[model samples]
Target: MGQLDGLKTVVTGAGGGIGAAIAVAYAEAGAAVTVVDINGAAAEAVAETCRGHGAAADAIQADCGDLAAIDAMLEQAASAMGGIDVIVNNAGVTRHAFILDLTEADWDRMFRVNAKGVFFCMQGAAKRMKAQGSGRIINIASVAGRGYQSSSNAAYAGTKGAVLAMTYLAAHQLGRFNINVNAICPGVTYTEIVSNLLRDRAAERGVTIEQMKQEAEKSIPIRRGNDPEDVAAMAVFLASPGARNITGQGFNVDGGLINS
Candidate 1:
């Protein structure tokens, strides 16, 4: 049997990038997955892929930044999947602006989806998990959260730091309920977010996007940026029985980019 046989998982932002990879990976492990994204079409596409892999999958479109939407999403997802055994709070956004250039709106938008969204999603999932007596929560944070030198802006970093901090607090409070909460700090992954950031940076430096990517690889000790699959693998492990004792921690999937 697969490691996640009979598991029910809900992954926000699963329409693409690392979130999509995680949802597919969970389905491949024999779990039913509810793919949540702001884009209905994208979510449906990912759900189809999961179903193609012979797993039960459903698509739901909801803005994680909206508490009401989050509440509805959880209710629908739980009903669709029977119950939630795992929740991956992978929905996040970043606006590239230095502190000096950053506007209040940018900061607010970043926190709305990145920080506050994570908090509400965790709360909704924890309620169900607590009653079930077991669950896994994986928040997608970034290496920027640790205050490392990154291409992202200060606001982005701040939001991630909040996510990591929330993960720790949630884990501490939920461990007694057999809930495992952890954060994944990915570094320069090849997602659309990074792609856009690289394009902008490349233009600023008068370099090709490919050249910019190569330069980024030099900073990572592994000499390579991460792939979505890299983060997904860790998420799968955290949802498995192997991670029963692991909680209240943040795992870096950054190929040693952030040494600390």
Candidate 2:
């Protein structure tokens, strides 16, 4: 039997990148999944892929940045899957700008999705999971959350930092109800988001993307960039019985980029 047989799962931003990978992995593990994304067509495409794996999958078009949309999506997801067991808050966005160049809009948009969206999603999912008395909440944070890092602006990092904070607080409050809340911080994962960032960083550094990548690889102990599957594997473990004892923790999936 698959590790997560019969579990109900909700994954936000499942249209592409790390979110899509998580949805597919959850399905392969035998969980029914709700793929939520602001892009209706992309969400449907991912759902179809999940169905191909023999897991019940539904696509919900919703903006994770909107509370009303999130609530609606969760309600529909629970109804479609029977009950909610796992929630992966994997939707995020980033902007490249210096402190002086960062606009008010930049900061507002970053927080709206990365921090505010996460908090509401966590709150909504926690309520359902608490009622059920068992659930797993896995958030997709970033290595930038730990502290200042290159290639990202101050505002972007601040939002992830907020996510890390929320993960711990939610874990503490939900643990008594047998709900496990944790955050996975990824380092240099080659997602669409990273691709966009790389373009900007490459121009700034006057180097090719490959040169920038090779330079980054040297700093990482594993000497490799992350694949979407790498992050997906961790999500699978968190949803499995193996991670039952783990909660309120931020696990880095960055190839030892950050020792702490």
Candidate 3:
């Protein structure tokens, strides 16, 4: 039997990149996964991949930033999967700009999706888990939350900080209910999101994508960038029975990017 045999999981932002990787990982571990994303087609594609791995998976399309939408999605997920044992709040967005150049809209949008969406989704999922008497809620944060001075917009960083704070509060409040809440802070991962950013940077610097990737890898003490599977492996471990004693902790999966 797989590590997650018989577990029902819901993974947000599973349409692509890290989210898609997480969904597949959970499925491979024997969990029935609900792939939720803003993009219906992409979500379905991931679900299909999971199904191909001999796991039961379903896809749902909803704007995670909307409380009502999230509520509906959770309800559907619960109904489809019988009940949700784990929730991976991996949906997020980033807007890169200097503090002075960032608009109020950009700030709000980042908070809405990265912070607000996570808050309500966790709230909804926690409620169900509380009733079930057990659950795992893993929020995806970033090294930006630990205070990065290299680059990235202020808004994106702020939202990640909020995610870590929320994870702590949720873990404390839900511990008594047998619900485990935690946050995973990844450093530089080679996802489509980061790939696009590197591409843009390469263009701006009149360099090739390969050159930009090398520069990014040099910044990490590990001498290489993280793959989506790296983060997914951590998520699987956290959601497994072995991590029952672990909660309210913010794990840094950034290849020694932040020593703390």
Most TM-score-accurate candidate: 1
lDDT of 3 at 221: 88
Off by over 4 Å in 3: none
Give the clash total for candidate 3.
0
Superposed Cα deviation of residue 79, candidate 3 (Å): 0.9
Off by over 4 Å in 1: none
> What global local distance difference test value does model 2 have?
0.92
Greater-lDDT candidate between 2 and 3: 3
Candidate 3, residues 91-188: lDDT per residue as tens digits?
99884566898998998898999999999999999999999999999999999888876446788999999999999999999999999999999888
What value does the lDDT take at residue 112 in candidate 1? 95
Please give, for residues 124-242, the per-residue lDDT of candidate 1 as tens digits.
99999998888999999988899878748988998999999999999999999999999999988999998999998888889999999999999888999988999999999999999
Model 1 reaches what TM-score against the true structure?
0.98
lDDT, residue 111, model 3: 97
Q: For model 1, which pairs clash? A: none
Local error of candidate 1 at 118, Å? 0.3
Provide the TM-score for each candidate, comma-separated. 0.98, 0.98, 0.98
